[model samples]
Each structure stands twice: as structure tokens, then as C-alpha cells.
Target: MKAAGILTLIGCLVTGAESKIYTRCKLAKIFSRAGLDNYWGFSLGNWICMAYYESGYNTTAQRVLDDGSIDYGIFQINSFTWCRHGKLQENNHCHVACSALITDDLTDAIICARKIVKETQGMNYWQGWKKHCEGRDLSDWKKGCEVS
Candidate 1:
């Protein structure tokens, strides 16, 4: 019985490790379109973390909150506002797509984040994003983040 339990644990670990890296190149290209290459490394990390917290990285994730409203996709974008910005699936342009816009559009999410940080904290406010991405190679995001 103990051996069976141990094997089950190993199986779970293996499966978890096998999880695919969902690094979407098109999304990164979109960021490049917005001229956010310099910040894409840290920005992508923050976007990943935020999406994980919001929807466990499920691009199709949806849920009904206690407020009797439905939240859609990876970033849990509430339906009404989501419709205002991006398409709903078919193009895979659900909440995840909208999130990509944070880096792609540049003005909306990036500007908003900076404002919030500057208002509550100060300039150089994105230091936290930089800190979180420390030691993680930025080369992976270079397609979108590298200026030169």
C-alpha cells in the first residue's frame, strides 16, 4: 500500500513536470508592435503570474463569482468589459488575448499599472516587476523585449 502511494506521488510529479510551456510567440510579437520590447521580460512574467492567480493559466477558464456575475478566461475578464476590447474565442481572443493587449496596446494595461504604482508608490515603481524577474533569462522574451 505504501509503495502504491509512493508510485502515485511520482506519477503526479512527472505529469506536473510534463506540463507544456505556453510561451506564445504571437503574443510576444504583439507586444513588440506596441514598442514594449524593453519591458517584455518582466512584463511577461508579471502577466503570467497575474493570469495564474486569476485563472490557473486556463485560457478557456470561466466561472461564476459570488456576485452573480460570470468571469471569463485566463484573466477572469468580466464579460461586459471584455467584449469592449477583444473577441471571445474562435480567435483565441478571450481574456488571455486581452491580457496580451496589456503588452500589445501598451497604453491601457502598462500605463494603468504605472499610474497605480506611481500614485501609490512612486516612479521606478515597476521595480517589483524587475525584482520578480531577476535571474530569469530575458532572452526568451527577446523577440518581443529586445530593442537592439
Candidate 2:
């Protein structure tokens, strides 16, 4: 049993680099405190729904886009534009490294996401928002999550 536990720990260290997948309510509470609720006319539900569809609340999620740009973190922020990945020239409008977006600390991610919304003037920057959340009743996203 001790050997098994050690192997599991080794496996996690080898395969997962600081990954944290948050439950909806827990993330909702965190986001609420981040002032995501009703931010720029987007309700907390919209933010919750976006987090779900973007990365399933995974803090270290990553996806490579068709154009070879990468999306990182719960927001799946693009590397080509919003952040610097240290590989190529990036717009880096948010002045954050893409690596910063994938850590357990969400401060960088949330700040960058807000900048994206502010620059785009809405949630249209995220396809997830356009498809799964737009014009939809997203009230249940934060329903049972008592966020004060």
C-alpha cells in the first residue's frame, strides 16, 4: 500500500503540473468575490457558464488553436493575442505571461479575462459564451452557490 501511494504521487508529479479542477459552486464563490458578477453587464451566471464551457473549471487546461495559438487556463485565453508565451511575438494586451494564466492562483487569469471583455465590449470574445450562454437562462449556474 505504501508503494502504491508513492507511485501515485510520482505519477501525479510526472503527469499533472499543478492542475486544479474546481467545482462550480466553489468557483462561483471565488469569481463573485473577484467582482465578476454583473461585471460590464455580464451576470455572475454568464461568468460561471463561461468558465464551465471554456475549461470545465480546470485551472491548468490548455488547448492549441487551429492557427497554432494556444489557449490557457479556465478562460482559455489565447496566447496569440492576450498573453506572452515566450515562444513568439504576442500582442500581450494584458501584460501577463501565458504561464501565469494556468496556475492555481487565478488573479492573473481573471484580470486578463476582464481585459478581454473590456476590449471586446462584451462576452463575444469567447465562442463558448456566444454558443452556450448567450440569450440562455443561465440563472442556475450560481443558483445553490451562496456567494456573499
Candidate 3:
């Protein structure tokens, strides 16, 4: 019984390290510091909305596509074009592993997302942005946040 209890505690600890869901204001502050607040004319609200739709602000979100490609992290960056997954050949413009994006630390994810935005049609690379964040009044995304 003692050993079983230890194992359960270890499992809980491991699961706790896997993912984190961030609040909107917390994300806004982080994104602002990263210069994503108005980068490429997209407001902070756009990014907030995108993150919500993509992974619900969860850092450990990952999805395997029908094409065998996988998307990782809050932004759901694709392995096929952005990051390398296992033995697959990838462009890897961000030069980071797909696994790196899934951590609670979002530094790698934000860096990779910036690269994707610069290379592609801005935030259009993310379908979530187009479907949810595009051309809408996004002032409410950062409404009460003191991000400066």
C-alpha cells in the first residue's frame, strides 16, 4: 500500500509538469514583452484569441493530423513545415524540436510562432486566427490587462 501511494504521487507530479493553462492577462503580459502585442499590425487581442482557439491556452496541447503531421503547443505549430518530429524531414525554420514547444515554458513556442508569422502571410498561417480573430473588434482581448 505504501508503494502504491508513492507511485500515485509520482504520477500526479509528472502530470502536473506536462501542461499549464494560462490566464488571459498573464498571456497578454508575456506576449507584450515578446513584442507580439502589435507585431505585423496584429493586435494583442488577435494573439489572445488565436491562442484560445488553438489550444485553450494550454502549453501541452498537441494534435496529430491525418497527414501524419503533428501540431504542438499553444499556437499548434505544424511539424511538417515548422518543426521536426521524429525521423521526418522538416523545414525547421524555428530550429527547435516539436517537443520543446509543449513545455510550460513558452519561450520556444513564441519564437517559433514569430518565425512562422514573418515567413508566411502574417497570422494567416493559423486557421484559428482567420476563423476567429480576423477583422473582428478584438479590444476585449486585452481589455483589463495592464500590458505595456
Each model's lDDT comes to 0.42, 0.91, 0.88
Q: What is the lDDT of residue 28 in candidate 3?
A: 92
Better of 1 and 3 by lDDT: 3
Structure candidate 1, residue pairs in collision: 37-145
Worst 10 residues of 3 by lDDT: 10-19
lDDT, candidate 3, at 128:
88
Task: Write the residue-wise lDDT of candidate 3 on 62-97 in tens digits.
Answer: 787999898988999999988887888987888898
Cα lDDT tens digits, model 2, 1-148, are 9999998788557435678999999999999999999989999999999999999999988888899899999999999999998769989999999889988899999999999999896899999889999999999999889974
- Scored by TM-score, the top model is 2
Each prediction's TM-score against the native? 0.34, 0.88, 0.87
Clashes of each: 1, 0, 0
Q: Which ten residues in a row have the lowest lDDT in candidate 2?
A: 8-17
Candidate 3 vs. true structure, TM-score: 0.87
Full-model lDDT, candidate 3: 0.88
Clashing pairs in 2: none
